[model samples]
Target chain A: MEAPERLGEVVQASTDRFTAQCYRLYGAPPLGSLVRAGEREPHVYGIVSSVTTSSLDPTRPVVARGASEPTEEAIYRSNPQLERLLRTDFEAMTVGHTQDGTIHQYLAPLPPHIHAFVFRCTPDEVRAFTQRLDFLPLLVGARTPPGDEVLAACLREAASAHDQPTEFLVQAGRKLALLLGGEMQRLNTILRRLPL
Target chain B: MTGREESPEVLGPQLLGVVVGGSLSQGLEVRLEDGGVVEELKVGTFVTIRGERHRFFGMVTDLGLASADPRLPSALPDTTNPAIVRILSGTSAYATMQVTPSLVVGGEETSLLLEGPQPARSIPFHFSRAYRASQEDVQAVFGAEDERHIWIGSPLDMEDTRVCLDLAEFVKRSNGVFGKSGTGKSFLTRILLAGILQRDVAVNLVFDMHSEYGWEGGSEEGHAVKGLKQLFGSRVAVFSLDEESSRRRGLSPDYLVRIGYDQIEPQDIETLAEMLNLTQNAAQATYKLASRHGQQWLREFLALEGREELAALADQLGEHQQTIESLRRRLDRLNRMAFLVERSPEDSVRRILEYLDRGTHVVLEFGRYGSDLSAYLLVANLLTRRIHDSYVRRKEQSLGDRAKEPRPLVITIEEAHRFLNPQVAGLTIFGTIAREMRKYNVTLLVVDQRPSGIDEEVLSQVGTRITCLLDNERDIEAVLTGASGARELRQVLARLEPKQQALIFGHALPMPVVVRTREYGPRTYAEFGFREQAELAREAEKDLKDLFG
Candidate 1:
């Protein structure tokens, strides 16, 4: 397949998978349902698992999985294919079982891709994701563009998860968000200038 | 025209020339329409033509007239006089003459050039002459007529002008009058005194050496003697070299103690010892003894000692024995010359102590006693001691009050060179006075004809100096060294005439000025109008001869 065709297919499958996982874990529709209803824009709800892969590799896929619910441990077991993919690609992993009996797991390969995704998520969306999940996955390596956005979202979620309102956590969250945004911008610039 | 020999005497107003060969020569002589020939054409002389004045002052380098009508008269004026026309064409008119003409006559009327008087080569004394100073020049040199400080003499504009110092600044630093004998130094000195005493603020203390000022106040011929006495009152005290008076008030042993002999070096004490025939050890012992037990101790020590012991102590001085002996001899001479009775050393010292306690300007008349160096030294030391005591007492008071009230005292030493010899070991009095006196408001006004004879160190420390007609080059150089603005002072000193001309240079004078001295007041001296005792015998013989005849 041509590179653009493959990239488009990957993006579509990731969006669908994230939507399904988010709905299963939260007992609610995907964040995109809100965008469809004109309440907000499409946003991801996931945990940062592992980050690996080069930002310059066009063939290398940027992957992440939605967090799981605590009550849905059986569901994670049923999704053997997804779990296997997460285990192979992710440098780290996190599983979440929500109170609604829905299981979810998140996996990210290519730190740049995770950073890009976190950079794109708003603070409110990150906060909402953190409220639905118990454990958050820590990003292990650098990523670019949508991966950076994903990392920023995860950091903001982690900060919101703290019991106490700490200046250090808030400041850290802000710095991580800025770093992710800068990385995404650098990756986008590089990609745009490519001869292809 | 007188004759045709002189080329027809240059007739008519126009000269008609004819072309001959390749040149145009005179064709015909044109006559004036008035039927007259032009006579003389002087350049500066005025001429009337057509009822308008025209000056004939330039040469006719070229003359021609162009006219369409041949009938018009072509006669030109004659130009011959050398004064009138410049043959060379570049000669300028005399500056006295006013007329200057341009070559192109453009119908402009020439100004009426009147000749002005020529400038004189030299200015004369009178205002009518060119040499006279203008009113502005007079004001610039002499200042305004109403100026208070400057005094304008009669014939004030002349170079013989005299400028009296403003008394205000003059009195701040006292003036000095000095000159060689027969130089009228004394005459000028008296004149300065007269002028100074006229001021309300003037206070003078004159050291009368020749008794000239003394006779002025009594039955004497000098004027203003009574006025001076009234001015100073009891402040002035005159000490004559009359045997009794000199002996009574001369420098005594107690005076040295009172003046603080503790400050005097052992050399001086040794000299004093030799003068009194005391042993070297005795002199040193006496000095130390005096320092501890005061003047009374010296008297007691001398009374208990034998003459042989004193002589042995003087011998023990060894190398300094001569100096010590000379000093002892000087002290002995002081006792005799001053006419003070030879008393015990203690009694003499006590007298000095008493005199110093009373602050009086003591003028010691050394003339009667003759020129005795020891007498001069003794008197000087006595006066110095008195002055030192007063200064120390006042200084102590001032210091006690944290320097609240300062008493300024000045000691004017006449014939200062005699006492301020650099060779003398104990002559530190002068150096001490120069360096330390200012702190106690005590100043030394040293008057001497030869400033070079004094110690250079002491001379250098003199903040103010009044230089009279110093004839010696060394003296002049010495004065110059102590003087501020030395270059100007040297110039003034070089031009100073004998007597009246003196270059007063120092902090006291604004600028060195040559000044004439003022006359002394009659009251400055006590025995006024008395002839000298030497002249009295001669006068008596002349009187007896006249009576017998």
Candidate 2:
């Protein structure tokens, strides 16, 4: 498969103007571009979603950043090991001064798949998958708007894979997907209007 | 002038205004104030003006205020306002003394005097500050600022401190919480757990039917996930139905149990057996077969190679074929009951016993488990057995040295009414625990919303009751009756709000307190929900993509 164009490099050519323009439109690049500078992994870019100052320790501040979806999942999966690194990265991005304090931030990676469906799996299947990876493929839209549809579709697909997808699962997923799409559109619209 | 000094003989009848029949003295006419002659003072307007004291204390019986001449010279003008003076009757010394020296009827300066001791000072029946446990005191005892430790929101108030308890004494031996839905019963449950955990002294064994307490502050992606593990460490063990753990061993699926037709007390059992394809004779023989083969006898009995083998065995047993056939039929019936029973592992039972033996805080997280009812019953039974065994062992050693041994463990069962059903088995293992555990130092903290649903005998055995607000009158009444000193508990219950609990009876507390539950650290079941964690993870993933990609 052909690799996508180096969009980052193409965008970087006009960094000053772009930065100035972006600052004028939205505020500061709330997150500093560490990856853009080639200091960190070139493929990885951290976006500062929020900067929270520490009330307990003035020196320690929290910077919430977005990570790639895979990276975020990894963080969750290996939480015990990654906590300090994420905390440090978050603090470095957000913290202006250092004092004895704690910082909190989420390192979420961009999702590889934009839309994924979730469905109920048999206990045996759930066990099989869960045991293999020590992590379950969580159903994202199990409760929310798109979640229900995605979950329904996922269940239907799973059932069909076994040649016995229940009619309920099939229909439920299709209907749920429509509902979920509408919810997603609404959420997107809301996010677009927000300052972030 | 004294009446004794004035002789009636000296003043003859003629002079005394009696002067034979119709005397002039009797015919004397008196002009009324309103220019109308009246025989006696008006009922409401009667006033006896004391000339000596120049004061009047009497009712303005009629509408004399409007009718009285405005131009008439008023006697004691400041005191003649009828609105300010109420008409007084039933004149006794007590009433008269209230008016005091201000009013004197005769020229001799007569005054009513009070002679006896004054009545004791009346104090309104307000709750004494000493008796009323304040939110601050409760917070001090139970509240922790850490998100992992606190159950209620910040800025704790009286609502956060409402505790329910019986009125018999300062400590409640046992109490429960029961509500239909959305009555904040779960919130109250969390508060109680948080309170106990905050003390850091008591070890809690929370059988979480619904995985509420296992996760406290950390979401699946963030703090709670890891925070829970760190905070609870070995103290908390989550036994989900989906997986086998050291603590989740030994739960037998109800279907696997051989049900004898003779053992079927109710028609429901017979129907259930029939639904499972067991003939009456087979059902009757099930008990004998199971007892002789031991507990796992059903599994071995079901493992008979084929129908041919089973038939051959039936022939070999000849006279016992009826019983064997019954057993075989009942085995088929058990398939339907598979969901109800869980085949408990020996290891899980041993692990729990180990915890009890070592006196460690163990929370069996059965929230994710499929068969909750069976899991709870099994754990309850296993714990009871271990407790009994330990007690027996300790008793044998205690005749020589009673004072030196460690006390038995205390078990806290959240949502206790679910397992301790009196209607089902007459006395559930939980009831047995309540009855027998006290002697072994194995205390039970039974938590539930419907206090009435719990077995009355078991409820009676509870020594410390910490109650929250209960809306159901029947539940309140049951709690009041079951708990000692519960007469005054209603007052506390009436005032309880969400998260507020009355600690009437407990070893540590003196009086019932409206207490804000302490903040629980991130390691409690209340904070953990698998679905919630998944959602958080999804959100985190999305945020990462938006920022980086």
In terms of lDDT, which candidate is strongest? 2
Each candidate: RMSD: 42.7, 43.3
Flag regions of model 2 displaced more than 4 Å. A1-196, B1-202, B216-230, B239-241, B244-287, B301-346, B402-407, B424-427, B484-488, B491-495, B498-508, B519-549
- Overlapping backbone residue pairs in candidate 2 total 96
Q: How many pairs of residues collide in each model?
A: 76, 96
Please provide, for model 1 over B1-549, each residue's C-alpha lDDT reduced to its tens digit, 9 standing for 90 to 100.
Answer: 011122422443222111111101211111111111122221111111111222111111111222222322332112253311221111111011111111111112432222211111221111110111223322232233222232312111233444344544444443343444444444544443433434322333344454343223322333324322233334434444453423453422111211222223343444334334556544555455455555454333334344555465455434244443443443343324434332433433334324433533333345454354444444455545545666577678877686443334445555666556565424435557765636655556566676776777667766545555677877778778755435334545654566444554444323334444333333322222224446669989999999996
Candidate 1: stretches off by over 4 Å = A1-196, B1-178, B182-235, B241-307, B311-331, B338-367, B399-407, B424-428, B482-488, B519-549
**How does chain B score by TM in each prediction?**
0.50, 0.50
RMSD over all Cα atoms, model 1: 42.7
lDDT of 2 at B402: 74
Residue A159, model 2, lDDT: 39
- Quality of candidate 1's docking, in CAPRI categories? incorrect
Residue-wise C-alpha lDDT for candidate 1, range A156-175, written one tens digit per residue: 44454445424324333323
- For A75-153, candidate 2 gives per-residue lDDT tens digits of 5465543343322111111111112331112222321111111112233332222222110012322233443233323
Error of 1 at B505 (Å): 2.1
Evaluate model 1: give its TM-score. 0.39
